[model samples]
Every structure is written in structure tokens, then in C-alpha cells.
Target: MVHLSHKFSTIPINFIPKQFSKHLPQQIPSQTTPPFIPFSQRQNQRSLLESQLISALNCCTSLTQIQQIHARILRKGFEQCCYVLTKLIRILTKMEIPMDSYAKLVFNQVENPNPFLCTALIRGYCLQGHVKESVFVYSEMRKKNVLPISFTFSALFKACGVVNDVDLGRQIHGQTILIGGFGFGFDLFVKNSLIEMYVKLGFLGCGRKVFDELPGRDLISWTELIVGYVKAGDMESAGELFSELPKKDMVAWTAMVTGYAQNAKPREALEFFERMLNEGVETDKVTLVGVISACAQLGAAKYVNWIRDTVENLGFSPTRCVVVGSALIHMYSKCGSVEDAYKAFKVMEEKNVFSYSSMIAGFAMHGYAYAALELFHEMVKIGIKPNKVTFIGVLTACSHSRMVEQGRQIFESMEEKFGISPGVDHYSCMVDLLGRAGCLEEALNLAETMPLEPNGGVWGALLGACRTYSNPDIAQIAANHLFELEPNAIGNYILLSNIYASAGQWNDVLMVRKMMRERGLRKNPGCSWLETKKGVIQEFFSGDMSHPRYGEMKQVLEDLLNRLKAIGYQPNMNSIAYDVSDEEERRILITHSEKLALAFGLLDINADFPIRIMKNIRMCEDCHSFLCAVSQITRRVIIVRDNLRFHHFHDGKCSCGNFW
Candidate 1:
């Protein structure tokens, strides 16, 4: 609601004479001019003076300076000159000065304002968020029969978009058609602006209509629509349009890459990026960011190395590019390499909130709570404001490390000290922290009494904690709400079922399973990824022993199991949620996706390399214990990144200390 014009009110206004005095000659010649200077010479002198005044206006840094220039223009007998006045208005607009306060007064003095001058005023008002005032100016211009130029319509459309006034935008669109004779109706620039407006207002259909009607569309026209579809989460439509675009530019290609990346289609994003590179399309930091995001989502060490090499070959150093560095930090973290993430963070010459947050979250993901908290404090000490995501990382660190009091104090400080109100996500983090710390009642009470309504994440966190702590009572309460809020979220049902199974409540487990069956919801199959020594990423699924190296993989698991059992490592059968016999449970535990991935890693990956596995679900207690025992028996480091967080096992201990 703050007006830009109000900020300049303190400057004193000096009134200049609107016309020459009656006592003086109607026209004053230049200094030392002959008594009867020729008319052509006088005209030349005026043109030169206009150019000089315009140049001065262009260099003006303040409204007072522009006002002084205006006085000079009036004294030089160019008061009605639209050329200089239009330039003056544009300068004032660029300075963000209020249009009505000074520009309107100067415009009123002009006997016949030109189209460009009016357009400048219109754009200035629009830019200052005065859409109605700009529209009024447009109406008055029409009343005077001042046919709007293409720029005028473009400015209006842009303004309407800013204010989200679709009705006004359509009215202006009608004006373009009604006043079509001036050739402004079919102006390419105006059409593109219209498309941009519709897209910004979430009127993609209207934008497409404008695009379809274009007599001759250019790259900007196509790019605008492509980006519009991308924003709408319609990547299929965006791809179809992109495929039809005869002349693909980097902007259009990047739109597709970024669109796929944002829509969680990372593989498609990378494929498109690869195609773009093959086609020799130029890449900038923006394109690199999309590719980096895609790689981060894949969370494969192979892609990590590929991206790092690609960036190096392209001469894009992380130390110089904050965007690339921040993304690398996240990618490294997700790929189970917090050490590499920290290295990337340390080498960055410039760090923003994103870079700091990514690094903190990376540390938190690896269960390096002290390191995450220390970096957060460093970020704050250096004057970088922590956003909600940063606090999420901080709270997650506390949640994982059981730092309850610190988490509580920081959650309280979020609103009181930082002025950031606790949103539902923050509340969820608090619930997670308290629940993970075994205060199930307190976590439930907090979720119920939160100022904002508790969302699925809040209840889901409590449910997950219930599974961890074997609390079926609290699990049922959280699951009931989750069932209503996210009816199709199979994970909630699975968690509730697991909690029941762990508590020996077979009836309740069966009931939850029946609910899932009735709703036709199936649990997501567990999948895991591991990169081999040759840098090929391999995928495995739970209970699927169809690998070409199935014999070797099974033999490796058997050998490790035998070695683990010698040291008193027994399988945690409670991990299974179904009603199965002991033999079936043992078979199911041995065929887990992560266990298979670990076996594959041992068989193919170099001995010196840490066995890194990425899973699509939480690691079960049995698998977790097996990995710990394997790491100790073999004296090898095994890192597993699950949906929740990273677990680095070495010397018979996990980074999470079995707290997870």
C-alpha cells in the first residue's frame, strides 16, 4: 500500500513561468544573437537545446534535478515540446517518481501531448501499482482522440497483469480490436505482451487463443506460451509445443528442462538437457541450474560426478556462481556425501541464504547436528536472514539429535525475534522434534493446539514417531486425522499398520489393511539405487532377485549374514508388518532392496569406496542392524540415504546412533 510518490513529498517544488512575460519579445534569440536571426538558425538552435536538455534529463539522479531541467526547458521556449517532455517523463518514471505529482502537471501544460509521452505516463503509473490511474489516463487519451500506440497497449496489458485485473485487461484487448486501424492491433510486441499478461493472470487458455491468432509468431511469442504451460504444471503440453517450435532457442529449451525438473521428472529433464547439448544450444547459469536440480533429485553419485565434470569442462566454477554452488551442496548432500557438500560450501566466495540453508540441511541430513547448528549461527552472525527452510534444517538437526530445549527455544523465537509467523510446516517440525524425543502426548497436544490447523505432515510425523516408539494409542489418533486429510496417502496406513503389528494388535493391523484395500491404495514398492565401480547406476526392488548377478549377490548376502551372526547380530523380525511365520519374516528381511543394493555394492564397487545406497523408503531396523554389523565385521564404511535421512555406518555404529 505504500505509494512511490509519497516518498518524494519532502522535496520543495519551485514553480516556473508557463509562458514568456508580455513585456519581453514573444521569442527570445540565443545570447549575442543578431537582431534578426534567420528562422532556420533559430530552429537549429532549438533542436540542439532540446537534445542537450534530454541528455541532462537522462543523467538526472533525483526529482529535484529533473525539476531544474524542466525549468531550463521552459526558459528556453520549449514548454510545449512533446519530444523533450516525453524524455523527461520517462526519466521520472525510471526514478520511480509518482506520475501524477509532477509528470501529470507537466503533461497538462502541453497543448498537444504525443502518444509516446502518454504511454510513458501510463507505464509509470502502472509500474507504481496504480492500475486504475493508468486506465483513467488511457481513457482520457481516447477521449481526446489520441490513438494509442503499440507501446500504450503493451503497457496497459502489463499493468493489468500486475494488478490481476483480467476484466480491465480484456477491456484493453477489445480496444486493440476496436481501434485496429492504426496497425497497433496486430503489433507483435502488443500481442506478446497480451500473452504474457494472460499467462501471469493464470489464463493460459486465453494466452493460447492469442498465440493461435498470431499471423506470424516469433520466438518470444512461442517462448511465452511454453513457459505458461510449464508454470501450470502441464509439462506434456509444454513438450508438444516445444517439439513443434521450428527454431528452438536456449530460453525455450531451458523452460522444458526447468519444467520437468520442477514437476519431479528429473530423468526427463536430464534427457532434454542432453538433447540440448547435442544440438549445440548455448547454456547459461540458468540452464545449468535446471540441470543441477535434476541431478540433485536423482541423488546418484554417478550423476554427481557427471555434473561436477560437466560444470568444470564448461568453466563454471562453484566458487564464482552462487546458484551452481548452492545446488551442488544439495546434490552432494542428497547423494550421501556431506563431506563433498561441505567442501563445495567452503569454496564458495559468495554465499546467500540458499547456499547456507542447503549446507545446513546437508549436515542435518547426515546427522551432523552440531555442525549444522554451528553453521546456522555463523550465517546469522554474518547478517544473512534465515528463512523458513533454514529453520527447518535447524529443527531437523535438533529432532534427529534429541536437542529438545534448543528446538523449543528456536521455534518460539521464529515469530518473536524474526517476525516470521510459525506456519504449518514449522509446527510440523515441532511435532516431529517432540515426537522423536519420546514425548508423544506433548507432540499430540502441540499438533492439536497449534495456531494454524495441523496438516498431514504434522500428524504424519507423530505417526512415524509412534511406529518408532511402538505407541499404538497415539498412532491411531494421528492416523485417523491423516486418513481424513490425505485419504490416499498409503504411507499413513502402512505406518499405522506397522505400529499395530509391532504392538501385537493383529486385529487393528488387519483393519487398517482392509481400509487400504477398500480405498484401492497400495504401498509404494521399496526401491534402492547403487552406483557400480564402472559408474553405472543400478536399481533394485524389494524381494526381486532377478539381477543377472543374482547368484553372486545372494552369495554375498549369505556370507555377510554368516559373518554378522558370529558376532551376535540377530535380525529384528518386528520390521515386518504382515502376519507371517518366523521363516517368512527372515526370508523377507534378507531380500530387502537396500540389503540387495549393499550386496551388489560389495560385489562390484571397489573395496576402498564406501558402499553408497539410496532407498525410496525408510530403512528398516533389521536392515539397519545388518548394515551396522556388516560395517564392523568387514571394517568398511557403508552409507545409505533413505527417504528420511542419511545413515553412515562404520565401526559397528551409525551416524544416527540407532536413534532413527
Candidate 2:
């Protein structure tokens, strides 16, 4: 084997001058061949051998085959061939062979490793989660004065992100500027890698700084910082960056859409998607999922149908695309159409844990405990392991249906059978289950003794249960903890106040209100949205008689109240926490946002379509009973989606069976 001397090592690592190739010894031809072979023929034979070795390495699937090839290379006296060795190390990395176990040994045997060879090893170690080992290799390369390529820094930056070692990343960053000078420092690929690393490490400000300092930037650089801001929940900054981008691609558009959906600004997400389509940008499964999520949040049937059509037109079939199908199931479920969710689930060609969990949760949200339980078992029977979300859905089903014993059995089996340790959410579901079933004392004990600290959801559930059974004492206990845990949550104060009102403890209710005043916390106004037959969404607020059709809506409500009174139905005066007259209480109940939406639905929505209304807060007891009577008297189906769950009213009955 021949080796290059250190005297000529000052040349760039990537370039080996032609003058050096002429001095290398040539492989001897076989004895059967002519000993006087021409120089060009010997060169051709060597070139053919190198090509054949590369092709063989490409086809090598196992380590044994690679070892056999390595032996053949040594026998042919190509041990110092950097090109073939580089390819070999890459293949080993692709096969996920550990760096220290095999590839490092191959690297150690090389007498003069070039830039590519060193980079391949560095990348391999980084990929294998050996960041320190990769850095050590880089240090050795520097000691030998082998300059690194752009990919070397990229690989190191990505590894630092994987291990969350920002300090090491900064050191590598400094080396890029020092060793390679500003030319390499300003390399587009390296800059993008730095931005990605900082973004992934939650240093969005650092990523933005890099972006702002780039002398020349591409769409990739712009999009990296945009995505970084989106991940940090800074949609304002993301939008500003996007506005300044001269060339917008599908990835950038998708980032904004997904960011809005995740941040609960669903309307903005839909609007951005619409603009993306109008600008002639293409949509993919990811973009469609974001749009579907936004539509689900709106919970309007008109938007639901529009998104369904858009999904089909874009060639994303729910039956074929698993992610799109799973998203559709969730969207339909959230839009108050569990039947449609099941339909989408039924047509899917493949089912994973997400699809099953969405279906079970849909059934649970609609109070179909038996259906949720059945699907849960079916998913388990088909070898799909239920995750934490799946158990939450199951326990929620038990809570809604008051299946206390079944819920207890499932909760106990979570860790013992499925190896899924219950999280805080699962504990909250258990508390809600026991609390909803009139076991307030037991639920309180569980919340106090649970391994994890009780969050707002746990105490909130207990307080809600107290309202259900008119237990102000337990409600006070839950509210006290909630006040400390969530000082500014207006819902907690309201829930506690409602419990006091239900128990005729007006003084306690006044005290809660006083505390809210002191904290400058105002109750969120009751708001509802109803879609007209023309697909226009109308908004209504409690005690706000400002709609253009307020006259007709008032007349409709008056007529309904008169009919309800004829049937011996009386107004639930306790629904109002204020110490007002009977007439004032009746007026306030009639002016509730949901009631107004119901009147608008009756006037504008066709009888063939069920009246669907979405509310921002939970429906009051007075409104729930009123809707049940209206559904029976008018012979109509009404669906109301509040903060917690869906209520389907038909023929004087609610799907919740009066338990919600």
C-alpha cells in the first residue's frame, strides 16, 4: 500500500492534484496477461476495478458482505483508496451500524483520511447519538489539518439539537467562522442548519438573529425562521416574517395554517388556507388537516360540508389517506356529527391508534358509553394498544353515563394490564366519574390522595358535581383549592357561585362575586353561533337584543314560552344567581344566548335540517330543559354543542338522558 507524505498536506482536503496520482504504484496484471501492458490500459483496468468495487458496496446488504469486500480491497492493494472507503462508511451509517463498533475501526485503518471520509464518520456518530464521539473525530480532523466540508457543520448542528446541547452547538458555530473563515461561515446551507438547530432548541430569538444577518437568503432560510416562531407560539412574529417573504411555498403556508390551528385561532387558519388556495398554491394532506381542524373548531355544518368537498377535490380520499381520514373523523366528531365520524372511520383502509381513539372519544362526548366501550374493546382485540388519550375517552364515557363500576375496572387495568401509567388527565377523568355519580366524598379523597397533584380540571370536576347534587359544602372545598391553583380562572368562581345559587346560599354567591370584582376578573359573556340556511353564521350574546331580526326572534321566544306554560312548565328561577323579581328572571332566561340562537334557527333554518347551535360556555339548566320541550313540541331535532359536550334533543329527550 502507498501513503501520501505530510509534505504535500497543505493542499485542500477535497482536492488531490493530478501530479500526485502519477507517482502512486499501479496494480500488477495477472501472469497469463502480457507483462508489457500499456500505461493507458493499466489506468483503464484500475478505473474499472474502482467502479466495480463501488457498485458491489452499493449492493452489499449485510456486514459480512461488507467485510468480504473490505478483504478484497486489501488483497487488491487499494487500502488507501479514500473514495471507496467513504462510500463504505456511508453504507454502514445507512444500515445504522454503531460507529464505535465497526465504522470507527475502518476509519482508524486509513492512513490519510480526506474531508469526505472524515465527514462520513462524523455524520455516522452524530446519527448514532454519539455527539461527543463525533466532536472528538472533528477535533482529530482539525489536528491533522483536514478542512471540513459544509456538510460537516450541518451534521454537528443537527446532532447538538438532538441532544439539546446548545453550548456544544455554539462552540461548533464558532469553529465554522474561525476554521473555514467567513466564506464558510456565510454558507447558505450552514446558516440554515444553524437556524434549525436554534429553533429546535427553543431559541427562536437566536434563529431570528441568524436570519436577519444573512447577506443572501433563500426561501429555505425564510421558512426556517417562520417555522421557529410558529413553534414558539409567536404567530405574530411568524406572520410578519411571512408577509415579508417574496416567494411563498407550500411549506411556509402550511406552517402558518398549522400554527393557527394549534394556537386555537381556528378562524385565522381557515382564512390563511383560503388565501393559499386563491394564490394558486397547492395543498397537501398536512394543509388539509389544518383546515379540517379549524373547521371543527367553528363547528358549523356549512363549513363542514365545504371542507369535505375541498378534501375530495384535492385528491385526498378519506378511505385511502390514513392521516386525512383520522383528521376527518376528529373534525366530524367535534362538529357535532359523531355518526359522520363513524362513517369516515368505517371507510378507512387502515386504522391506527389515532383513528380508534378519535371514534371512542366521539362516542364518549355524545354520551354513548356502550358504543365507546365496544369500540375500545374492538381496538384492543385487533391488537391496537390503547394510549393515554384512549383511556381518557373511555373514562369520560363512564363518567357521562354514570358507569362507575365499569370505569373503576378500566382505570385499575390501565397500569396492571396495558402498562400505561395513568397521567393527570386520566386522574381528572376518574374524579369526574366518581363525582358525577354522586360520590363527592370518595372523589375528594381520591383527588387528595392521588400520586400527582390535582390540576384545575380535577377540582373543577368536583365543583361541577356539587352543583349537580346541590352540595355547596363540597363545592366550597373544591373552590378553595381551585382559587389557589387558578387565581384568575373566571370559570371556577362562576361554578362555585352557581353551586351556591342552586343551594339558595345567595350570600356565599355574593362573596364569590366580590372576590371576582377584587381580582378584576369578569365572567366571559355567554355567546352562541347559529348557521342560517344560506350558510351565514350569526352570533348572539346573552341579554344583547341587537340582532337585525330581534323583533321576530322575540316574538318566537314569547310564543314558545306561552306554549311551554300551557304544558305546566315553569321557569327555573334558580338558574339566575341575582336576587331579582320573577318577571326579571323570566326575561333573563328568555334572553339567554342559546335561546336566541334557537329562535333564529327556527325562523331561518329549514325544517328538514336539524337546528345546530354552538355555544362558548356550558348551557344552563333552564335552557337545557327549554330545548327539550321545544324539540318535542315543534317535532324537530336540535343539536347544541357547548364547552364540554354535545347535547342532542329529540322528541322530549336528550342524548345525555338528563344526566349532563
TM per model? 0.81, 0.80
The residue-by-residue lDDT of candidate 1 on 7-101, one tens digit each, is 43433323322222221233446577568869999888777777777766767787767765666676666778899889988998899888878
Which prediction has the highest lDDT against the true structure?
Answer: 2
The C-alpha RMSD of each candidate to the native structure, in angstroms, is 5.7, 7.2
lDDT tens readout by residue for model 2, 1-660: 222222223433223223323322334356686668799998997788888678767777887666656655665657788898899899999999888877888788798999999999999999999999999999999999999999999999999999999999999989988975647878999999999999999998888888888999999999999988888899999999999999999999999999999887888999999999999999898999999999998888888999999999889988888889889998999888899999999989999998899899999998899999999999999899999999999999999999999999999999999999999999999999998899999999999999999999999899888888889998999999999999988888877887887778888889987898789886577999977888888999999899999999999999999999999878777567555688888888999999999999999988998999989888888899999999999999999999899999999999877755
With a 3 Å backbone cut-off (N, CA, C), the pairs that clash in candidate 1 are none
Give the residue spans of candidate 1 off by over 4 A.
1-50, 63-93, 96-118, 125-147, 152-185, 198-206, 232-236, 383-389, 408-427, 439-455, 469-481, 503-507, 555-590, 617-635, 657-660
